[model samples]
Target: MMTHTETRSAVLSIGRVYCDLIFTGLDHLPVLGRELFASGMEIAAGGGAFIAAAHMAHAGRKVALAARIGMDSLSAGVEAQLRESGVDLRFVEHAGDAGPQITVAAVVGQDRAFLTRRAGPALPATLDAALDWEEACHLHIAEYATLHEIPDLVSRAKEKGLTVSLDPSWDATLIYDRGLLRACEGVDLFLPNLEEAEAITGSADPQVAIRKLSLAFPLVVLKGGAEGAWVMSSGRMLHAPAETVPVIDTTGAGDAFNAGFINAWLNGASEEMCLRAGIRFGSLAVQAAGGARLLTTAE
Candidate 1:
C-alpha cells in the first residue's frame, strides 16, 4: 500500500466547508408539506474538500485543508472532527459572527438530497496567503465555483511546481456556461461525474463528454456511480468496475474516490491501479453512516 513517506507529497485541498447533518435509513424522500421519519441521524464534518482531505489522511497521506469556517459553537465541533481525522488545519481561516455552514442531507438507500445554507463568502482573503505551496506536491480543488472565484488558481499552482486536479462538483449555474470549459484549461486532471460531464458538454453520452473534456485537460476521470468509472489519459481509454458494498449514504463517495486515486497517482501507480484504488475507497465510504466516517479507520 502507498504511504505518506513513499510519496513524500502532501495534498492541499481547497474549497468550502460545512457541518453535514445526515439523516439515514429513510424509506424515501419526503414529499412537499410532509414529514418523514428516519431511522438514524448524525452530524459530521463535511464538504467535498473535507471529505477528500480526510480520506487522504486516513490513507496515510500528508493532507492539508484550506477553507473558511465560522468561529461559532457549531463550527467548534466540526473543526475538532477534521483535526481528529488527521487533516492539517493550519490553512483553515476563521469567519467571525457568521455561524457554521450547515447542510441537511436526507439519505434514502444509495441516494441523497441536500439543502445548504452557507455562512459567509466561500473564500477568505487569507486563503492564498495561508497556502504553503512549497509543502504541496498536488493541489486538489473541490468545486468549479471555487476555481471561478480564483481564476488564476491552476496557473498559480503550476508556477509553484505543483500539479493540480479539480472535481467540478455540480454547479447548477456554471454547468451550462461555456466559460466552465475555459476554466478547466491548464488543469492536469479533471474529475466530473457522468451527469455533471453531460451537463457541462451538452452531450447526452458519457463517451462524447469524456472526449470533449480530454481535449481540454491532459487527464479526464469520469465518475459513474454504479457503473464504475472511466479514465481517459494520453488518448487511451480505461475502465474500472465498482466494488459491491452495502449502501448507507452516498454523501462523500466521490470525494473518497478522488483521495484514493490521487494517493495512488502520487505513488507512481498505473492508471488501472489508481482506478481500482478509487473504487475501493468509494466502496468503504458508502458502507458507513457519515461522509468520511469509514475513512477514519481505513487502511
Candidate 2:
C-alpha cells in the first residue's frame, strides 16, 4: 500500500455523511401519550465530512472527499449531490455492510433532537488513489476515518511541505494520559471545541487551553459559540466573535467554521478574516434547515 506525498494547496477532507431529516415547530416536548404537530419538515444531506467538503467546494477551491456511503438509493442521491457540487468524488466509496446512516432530527424553535441508525463503517478505499494525490495542498481528516488507516499520510504530507489540520473525536470516559495529546501530536493546527479542550487540559478557559496546546501545535483554534472563537498562534490570541443572528439550528456550525477558516487562510486572508468567514458560514448554516445544503446546492 503506497500513498502519494505531495504539497499541493488543495483541501482533502474525510468524514461521515448522514441524511438530515428535520421537523420544525414542535410546540412542546411530546410525552409518550401526546401527539404534536410539527410546523415544517425537511430532508437534506449532511454529516461532518460532506458538509466541510461542500463548503470548500462552494468557495471555488479544489476539494476532494474520502467518505463512505450506502449502496442504496440514499447513497446514490448523495453521490449525485456531490457530483453536482464539483467535489472530487473518486474517493467516495459505497459500503455493502450497512445502508446509509440516517439522522432523524426534530427542530423546535432553535433547538433540535435527533435519532439515527447506521448500516456499517465508513467505506474503505484502496490507497492506490492517494498515491495519485500529486496536487493536494492540504489534508484534513476527522472522525470518519481512523488514524491507523492513514498512519503514513501525515509523515508523507510533512515531507512534501503541506499544512496538516486534524480534528480528533475522542472517547470522553477514557483515562487521560499521553495518548490524548498524541492523537493530534504532529500537525500544523488542531481545532477542538470548549468541551474537548477541557477534557484534554482540565481547564475550561479557551485561552488557557489553547495556550498550552500551542506548545505542541504551531496553531490552535478553539471554538466557543456566542462567546465567539479564539485563535492562538504565533504567540497571539485573537477574539473571533459570532455575529448577532437569530439562532435557527446549530447542526453544522463547527464544520462550517472549519471550512470558512481554512478557505480564507489558503487565500492569504488574516486570522480575523479566517474566523469571520467561519462565523459567517456558521450563521448561514444555522439559518438553513440542513448542514450540507449550503455547500451542495446553490444558496
Q: What ranges in model 2 sit over 4 Å off? A: 1-7, 27-37, 108-114, 148-153, 159-161, 169-178, 295-299
Per-residue CA lDDT of model 2 for 132-180, tens digit only, reads 5777777776541344445565676567656777665443434244565
Instruction: Give lDDT tens digits, candidate 1, residues 1-299.
Output: 23334343888999888899999989899899998999999999998999999999989888888898888888998988987898988888887844678989999878899898777666756666545445678889999988888888888777776788999998787877888878778888888999899988888687888988999988899999999998998889899889888888899899999988988888888889999988888889998877788644465
Candidate 2 pairs with clashing backbones: 4-131, 8-136, 8-137, 9-137, 10-137, 98-119
**What stretches of model 1 exceed 4 Å from their correct place?**
1-8, 295-297
For this target, which candidate reaches the highest lDDT against the unseen true structure? 1
TM-scores vs. true structure, each candidate: 0.94, 0.84
In candidate 2 the C-alpha lDDT for residue 251 amounts to 71
Query: Per-residue error at 273 for model 2, in Å?
Result: 1.7
Worst 10 residues of 1 by lDDT: 1-10
Candidate 1, residue 38: lDDT: 91
- Rate residue 272 of model 1 by lDDT: 91
Residue 157, model 1: Cα distance from true site in angstroms: 1.1
